[model samples]
Target: MRLENVSVRYHRRGPWVLRQADAEVGPGEVAVVLGRNGAGKSTLLQVTAGVLRPTRGRVVDRPRHVGWVPERFPADQPFTVAYYLTAMARVAGLSAAEADRAVDEWTSRLGIAGFRRVRLADLSKGTAQKVGLAQAMLRPPGLLVLDEPWEGLDAAARDLVPLVVDEVLAAGGRVLVSDHRNETVRLPGARRWTVAEGTVTETGPDEPEDVAVVEVAVPAARVAGTVARLRAAGHQVLRVRAAGRARDGATPGVGPRPPAADDTALPDEVAR
Candidate 1:
C-alpha cells in the first residue's frame, strides 16, 4: 500500500490534520505508527483503510483490500453481538450462511462466544472492542489498519493483541497501527514511523538503559579507546577511577589483595 502526497485539510482554521506525507507499507511487514493525540494518527489510519477521503492526493492499495478497527465502532442499534458481526461481513459481501459461519468463527476466537446473542449495547467496552477486532480480521484483508485496537481491552484481550498481529503477518498481510502507551513489541526487522507535527520520520536507535555508572579501572593510556569501544557497544560511560585511588580509599584490610584472592575485583554492573 502506498500513500502519495496525502494531505487532509479540515477547515479554514488552519490545518487540523495530516500534511503532505508519503508512506509505503509492504506485506509481511508490521509498521507501528506513534504520535501524540490529535497528531492526525487516527486520520492517517482512516485514510489508509479507505474509510475517509483525503482532500488532496490519492491512496493506492492492492486487491483483497484493507481492514480497520476505528477508535469507535457503530453498535447503536438493537442488534446482538453476533448480529452486528454478521452485518459487517454482509457489508463486506459475504453470503448469508457464509457470513454467519464467519461471525461464529471470529466470535469464538475473540472469546465472545458467550455474548454472541447479547445486545452490543449491553457488552462492556473491552468486549465491544473485541467484536470490532474480529470484524476487521474475519476476512484477513491485504492491509490492516488499526487505531488503538488495545484501548479498553481487559488484560487477557490485551495479551491477545500481539497474537492478532501475528495472524495478520501470517496471512501475508501488511499492517499500520497507531499505538499509544509505549507498547513493547518485538517485531523483527519491522519499520517504525513516528508521526509528529503531521510529519513522519523513521526513528533510529532507542535510548539506553537507566543504570547508574561506575567507572572501569583501565590503563589511563587506553581509557579513551576503551570508552569509545564501550559507547559503540551501547554502554553508558562515567568518569574513570584510578586503580591507585581505589587502593588508597580501600577499607584497611581490603587493600592489596592478591589476584587469586580478589574474587570481588569486578563490580556487579560490569559482571553482568
Candidate 2:
C-alpha cells in the first residue's frame, strides 16, 4: 500500500495535518509511525486506513482491501461485545454462523470471554480495546491500520496483542500501527516513518535523531527473560521500562519511554 503526495485538511482555508506525506508498506513488512503525542501520528494512520481523505494527494492500496482500528473505537451503543463483533464479522463478509464462530474463537483467544455477554458501554477501556483487535483479526484484510492498539490493555493482553500481529503478517497481511510503545520497533524488518511539521519522512538507518522512546509492560519477575529475548532478537534494549508507581512489593509491567529511532542505535532499557 502507498500514499502519493497525500495531504489532509480538517477545515477550509486551514493547514493540512499531513502534507505531501508519501508512504509505502509492503506485504510481509510492518512500518512504525512515530511522533510525540498530538503530533499528527494518528491522523496519518487515519488517512492510510481510508477513514480520512487526503486534501491534495491520493492513497493507493495494491490489494484493494484494508482493515482499520482507531485510537478510540466507536462503541457507544447498547450492544453486547459479542453482538458488536458479530456485526463487524458480517460486514467483513462472514455468514451469520461464521461470525458467531469467529466471535467465539476470538473472544476465547484474546482472553475476553468473561466480558463477551456484557454491553460495550459497561466494559472498561481495555476490554473495549480487545474488541478492536478482535474485529481486525476477524477479517484479516490485506492492510491493517491500528492506532494505539494497546492503549488500555493489561500486561498479559499487551504481550498477546503482538503475537496476534505476528500471525497477521505471517499470513501475508500488512499492518500499520502507531502506539506509545517500543514493541513496534522489535517487529523484524518493519519500516519506520516519523511525522512532524505536517510532513512525513521514511526513516532509514541514517536519519537524524528526533525522540527515542519505546513502551513495554513487563512484570518484575520476567524482566531479565524479556530483556534476553529482545537482545537476542537484535533490538536495542532501551531498558526494561515500567510505567506508573508500583505498590509495595508488586511486579510492574514495563512501560514505553523514548528511544533513539535509529535502527542502529542501541539503547539501554531503564530497568525499574
Clashes per model (N, Cα, C within 3 A):
0, 21
Query: Each model's TM-score, in the order given?
Result: 0.71, 0.75
Error of 2 at 66 (Å): 2.2
Residue 47, model 1: lDDT of: 82
Those runs of model 2 whose alpha carbons end farther than 4 Å from true positions after fitting are 204-272
What are the candidates' C-alpha RMSDs? 12.6, 9.6
C-alpha positional error of residue 76 in candidate 1 after TM-score superposition, expressed in Å = 2.1
Model 1: residue 183 alpha-carbon error in angstroms: 2.5
What is candidate 2's CA lDDT for residue 193? 87
Candidate 1: lDDT over CA atoms? 0.73
C-alpha lDDT (0 to 100) for residue 12 of candidate 1: 70
Q: Which one wins on TM-score? A: 2
